[model samples]
Target: MKRILVSFAVLTSLAGVALADTHGAIAYSPSTSAIGWSYAHANRGDAETVARRNCDSSANDCRIAIWFRNGCGAVAVGHRGGWGSGWGYDGREAQRQAIRSCRKQTGSCRVIRWQCSENE
Candidate 1:
């Protein structure tokens, strides 16, 4: 009986952890870098706000907004000289450039697109 009870407790604890939302959803170009960039950002900080903002703005081409429960990291795309007047960049270079530029900002703004290039 003792062994059975102990096994049940362990299983229950494991199941709880498995069911938790441990990672955020990531999306990337089919040809460009990996899509799980946002997941990495969430791992470093809060994943919920990051996932919501990115997922919601994924379809839009204007502002690729990133939010955190603590703060925010964003890049103004589709603005002055922005891709397609804000439609945003279509190629990998454009995305990478944007991320690189965003990273230059001070504070938690280091997230800049939260990108990760496996090739690089």
Candidate 2:
């Protein structure tokens, strides 16, 4: 009964970063409740691969929820089987957005994971 949506902002036009870009991605499987994440990776593809590969060890339906460069990302899960993800320049902002996004279709949701990676 889990519903998940992934944002395709990967390699977007405004994907340029500052001096250094530390890529990160978060993967989750609602069915198995498995979570995997990568931070400070070389590129988006690598970051996503690591996260998905890690989660794949435990989940059959794991999907990349969010990706970000030189920032933070978060995932929120609702008791009613709803999930959402958000990323921002900081952990608090990322978590806030994650909860807000989750509350869109759910009422009882809380953040399960969050991480930040600054440009090096």
Candidate 3:
């Protein structure tokens, strides 16, 4: 019974850790035609602020593409007018999805940024 109580306590602690919030953000700049990304922030605002700052450093007209909590985000641009973004639990999957989304809109697409929040 004592061992069971100890195990329960450990599990509860682990659960709390897993529940902690983590954030990721992606921003795009039209002036420089660049994308900036930030991840593993403790809050959504921090992640978005960092990403926007990074983008603004290189160019003007910066805008956030996405913000994710406990997940991943990605952005893609196409040869013509197609642009896409995706968010998911897996970083690679998010990137792939972003590219895929862009391709659906246009024939050519490439990934610009991919970021993931730490799961804990």
Candidate 4:
């Protein structure tokens, strides 16, 4: 009986963790080199607000680059001021997409930021 109860309690705790929302966002300056990113918030609104606020600390024209929930997000930049944002189930996939998007506008694209939600 004790063993069974312990297993049940662990499962219940895992379920509650899985139900929680993990929000993330990235913000960038339109005409500057400023960028800001955030992750693991409770909701999308808070994530975006924090990202934008951080970016705005360095520049006046900051904008949201991307927002994600329960996944990975990436930012890529290239020569000639090209920029891109992507979201995916994993970090590699997200970086690939960001580079792909940036390549459309300019060459020599590379990932500048990448993070996975839930610490994955």
Question: What are the clash counts of all predictions, listed in order?
Answer: 1, 0, 0, 0
lDDT of 1 by residue, 20-118 (tens): 433332232222222222443325344534544544344433222332222222232222222210112122443444455544442222222432311
Tell me, by lDDT, which candidate is best: 4
For residues 33-56, write the lDDT of model 3, one tens digit per residue.
677778889999999998888885
TM-score list, all predictions: 0.29, 0.80, 0.80, 0.83
1-120: candidate 2 lDDT, tens digit per residue: 122222334334335543567888899999988999889897999999988997858588999998888899999999999989999999999999999999997888899988776532
When 1 and 4 are scored with lDDT, the better candidate is: 4
Off by over 4 Å in 1: 25-36, 40-45, 48-120
lDDT of 3 at 8: 100
List the pairs of residues colliding in candidate 4. none
Q: Judged by lDDT against the true structure, how good is candidate 1?
A: 0.35
Q: After superposition, how far is residue 100 of candidate 3 from its true place, in Å?
A: 2.8
Scanning candidate 2 in windows of ten residues, the lowest lDDT window is 1-10
Best by TM-score: 4
The TM-score of predicted model 2 comes to: 0.80
Model 4 residue 107 CA deviation (Å) reads: 1.6
Q: What stretches of model 3 exceed 4 Å from their correct place?
A: 1-11
| Steric clash pairs (candidate 2) | none
